[model samples]
Target: MAAQQPSEKILVVDAQADSAKLIVLQLQEAGFAAVWARDGEAAIGMLDGDDYSLALLDIRLPKANGIEVLSHIRESGKDTAAIMMTAHGNENLAVECMKAGCVDYLSKPFAMDDMLQRVMRAMTNRRVLLQKQRLEQEKDDFVSMLSHDMKNPLTAVIGSIDIIREGRLGTVNQEQAEYLHAAIDSCNEVIAMIDNLLDIHRFEAGRMQMKIAAYSAVEILRGGTRRFTRIAEHDGIRLRERLSHETPRIAVDKNAFSRVIANLLANSVKFTPEGGEIVVSCRCLKGAEVPWTRLPSYVTVPDGFAEKDCFVQVSIRDTGSGIPPDDLGRIFERYVQSRSGVGRERGGAGLGLAFCKMAVESCGGIIWVESEAGLGSIFVILLPCYLNGTECTGK
Candidate 1:
């Protein structure tokens, strides 16, 4: 640990010259690269100038004060850790600093050895946090690239299969048509899985790019159902659409939006038994009409969505074995596995919903679910309606 400390630079912010110098020297001697700042303001400047592993801050300072400085770090969302030190050490103030995201707190005139241990702990914490973030980023990148690469060839194969099925190459018999349909279905299932993984990774990493364009909500919904029609029928299930007479255009990434629709429909088709019915419906929703209270926390609706005037709401209601009541709240979370029929037994426990939630939120939309144990489920989405690249206000 001592040998590794040289890589971690620490900031010591104390008004008292003697105390600050002593602390900096101790850290330097212990193999860390320590810098001294005479006040909170100077600490802030140092923070901005270079990457610091941790900050040893004094609660009382000439400018800005320790709490204010820490607040700045947090508000800036920098990857820096802080440990508050104060001459007037009170239990309440320590608790307050801790709550303010300090790694540790120390009183003036404290033992030098004790302070070093605290510094080491804070450094360790920072190291762990940074390592975790790096691992998560790597995982996300791996999945994103994997899925993107797999999708292209799979798509080409599907297109070629479609051409053959349509007799573009030659005449096709009924049996051959059945075989081609099976092949298409298998390829589509793979595609949907790949899309789910890719989108979920991109969304989680905040790297998802959307090419927002307006399209008829009804048409988008209908197009989503086309691929699933044969699969549902083959499973003895009915797949249909229920679009309103007055459907509005929705601004979204057409491909991602269609993928969202496909994900929900696929889920419905997977669990819904033979003879079950799946209805894809589209309607308009006022911003105030969204049941915000019932919308689960797992759905990541972006800021200001609640204030939109008009939205295009699409709901995929299925007569499948409904989600377990306890799982509804977490169904949209990544990797969530419900205990009921929607559990890991059938695969894709929580990934599809995560992708759906993120996709909707990317368009400044909201997505949620409603269901009981045996009453089937309805996955509802509300994407803000836009006219010419701007959100539509209710007329």
Candidate 2:
């Protein structure tokens, strides 16, 4: 049961002045502040000017009806709960009012005790709704605070590991160097996890602002893929890229674009086994060639872009264990991971792909994946080409 508020208010709207007075007297005696309205129009005017926890609306009223007032309240997004007061034969009308968002209804000639009980119940439900909203807000604030506090210490640890791996303090033997390198890698992984946590919070809170500008798609893809070459080679995997010179520049947040590419490459590297090959490729595509329906829900196109606009497509294809059909649909959701054993073995907090999806979508692009179990996966990113007055022909 929801908690009760002692200062709750109720509005009583009745065409009969006597009925309205009696109802208001009963509500006031029940410890609720009661206000009276002679008809539906007056009730609506009062509702617009004041905040009432519940409204007791009579079906029969002068000038306007209870149902019409209820519709206006709903359309205005008021949080007030409502109960309809109907005559004995108006059961059908009461049902219709309930369907139109009335919380409860009382028949005419109802006992004062029953009226008070219904009022209390409606107020309690409203209290519960407000409480739930407050709790959700608190939870988001707590997560933001925790993620921010974790970054400072993790940054210092990453810096120390970098120093040791680079031999800034002294010379080190081959075995020692290998151990240091592993330590550095582990530290970097922790830092990445911390960054993902922060980014997810910012994305959900709408605080992740993007610095949009025109940038070469080729340069972004090449630079992003180049960072992972040493890691791929170390794992005995072949990494290559194929870029089309005809690809146009894309308007996006440079840092966010880089992070999106990094996350995709990291995901591919984690799943691809030894002797596997991963290819990063880019090309131009006409809007007709793009499959909008197949795109994940996190991806959204900008409003002005249409089916005739030109786009640049970047694909990362890997020879790795692909996702199971069931998990593929939810792969980009926050904190969701594949149920496959591979996901369990390759541990993550499952925010990498989610971040990539949000970052790409923030730039008015789409990200999607195509995969079959044991046949490897292909991840694609489609971004709007910067046309700049020249007609884009997907050259």
Candidate 3:
């Protein structure tokens, strides 16, 4: 079999047959795989059916307007770079096209050189963006996997401290108990941080692997709730766990997966004031979709995937002094502690949600949150079922 050569694919749309044909010749002459569409509707149909590296759009088309096509492209969540062509009087329309997410604009009656330049620029930008995304993804995956591996040791260390506290090793004096308590507290803090790092790293990496076994979601929820009972009581906060159904034995990694749920729960408890309420719940996610609209050009999602397949969704909601709207996107970023002066005072490194993201992603899932400052916050995680090994298409 002959090796298939990789080729740059460009889509050309123009109502004017001559202009479109000219551009197509240039692209083909330059060794690109080009598809020509006569109008906006045809362009959109082609885009929906095939992957194109760049789209050359004429602002005026017969069936659908260029701006309308651009809007549809933005809405469909495929970020194909669009270069709009406008006649002289349509400069303002070109600006409008740019606002509609056109990568570059070309005035009509332009030289072929100018057209080639713009197309080349758009293609170059797309490649650069894709490369940057891959690099960041790789870094996140490495860190997340490392964090998961480190957890066993952290768990053992914490477990040993508990044994000593119970006098399993030997009896100790009051002064020793106090010192041990302080040491254990410090260790717990570090462990929490490590957990956060692991979660964030995995989430950012976008490589979630699940080790599915039959287990009750309700049991996991209750276990997580019970684990935090003492702290909730101490803090005077009301914590509730609700199960919409007797959750079936679903496939999951109890320890790694529960940690994500626990992290959200812990954050709620930490951020919520005394007398505030924290609710942890498990329910089916119906009609849930990601805002892939803003994704830049050059990203491609594989088949057998839907935004929903990202995970079995879990949500942790809290009635704490909530996060500001502006900070919602950045909150999951490492060290972006929204609490800032207050959060620092409360002692947070801002890795909790980031970690949640990583852990969820490692299990082939996603994590996101909804919150308004002074209102409250709801952190949601989605993990895929059937905890199989990662399928590495490697883009």
Candidate 4:
């Protein structure tokens, strides 16, 4: 392996001019880029002007002192590691400095080797943290680029398939039409997967913005179920809904909410055996009536809704092979799938539930699943109701 490169820029702070110069020289000789500050005020000023990997500070300094400088650094939320130099023998002062966010400390008249070692260790840690952040950013960029590039071609292919299916391109025989339909379905699945990947990438990077508006809860439920009715019938399954007439309007990103419901329906359609039954239901309930244990970790009840009298509860229940007990806890996690044979037979990218979880939580809702092997599974979603004439408070 190639030798690691040293690239940390360090700041050395001391009231004594000679001590500061000596430390800067030592750091330079050790292959570190170092800047010297004769007082805490100068150190603070330098920090604001430049990015640094670490700061070496003396506890005794003219004007502002080391503790005050460290406190300011912490308050500013800069990720620079700090090592304090203290001549005071009191352990309490050392503890106080640590509580003030000092990463390590040194005593006056410390050996050059020990000081250099501490500096190296702190810089190494900073390098690791920076590397992690960079990798995460790169991953996000890759996913975004891939999704954008694939979408155009996929859309073109789907449009062409639609044209052919409509008999616009000469007459197609039954066999040819069947194969073309399969190809179209496969293309659509790939498009859905790409969309899911993009959604997850945006969500994790905190770029997802909710376009909230008032919408009827019953209409949403009916629309979602309607889209899957024909597909369920083709598979010899029954898709139905039990929405309450008194269901209130909900303010949410209509597209996102619809996507969540579609994903749930897709999951149920995929796993439910032929002739199985699926039900989509919605009802208004009090926050206190929600089963908190069924809520996933990502979902949170908004503070504004805590005192409210009502919330919306939606459930998609299926009578099919249920999830195994061991896999229940992880079904909502990205790329996780049940180990049951059914999941293996019905192949997917395993992102539907994860996307559902994120979309629901973004609207200040909770989603969870209750399943038992060989019985059935019930996926539940709880959303805060949008009272008429009142503005919704969450996004």
Clashes of 2: 0
Looking at candidate 4, the ten consecutive residues that score lowest on lDDT are 1-10
Q: What 10-residue stretch in candidate 3 is worst by lDDT?
A: 294-303
Model 3 agreement with the true structure over 154-214: per-residue lDDT tens digits: 6688788778877889997777776676566556667878766654554455644557565
Candidate 2 residue pairs in clash (backbone atoms < 3 Å): none
Candidate 3 positional error at 206, Å = 8.8
Per-model TM-score, in order, reads: 0.71, 0.74, 0.49, 0.83
lDDT of 2 at 250: 87
**By TM-score, who's the top model here?**
4
Give one digit per residue, the lDDT tens place, for model 2 in 371-391.
998889999988878866344
Clashes of each: 0, 0, 17, 0
lDDT of 4 at 345: 76
Those runs of model 1 whose alpha carbons end farther than 4 Å from true positions after fitting are: 1-110, 156-173, 285-311, 342-346, 383-395
Comparing 3 and 4 by lDDT, which wins? 4
Quantify all predictions' global Cα lDDT against the true fold.
0.84, 0.84, 0.72, 0.83
Quote the lDDT for 335 in model 1: 80
Cand. 2 TM to true fold? 0.74
- Model 4: per-residue lDDT, tens digit, 88-165? 585578678988788888888889989988887777777798899899889977887777788779889989998998
lDDT accuracy of residue 144 in candidate 3: 61
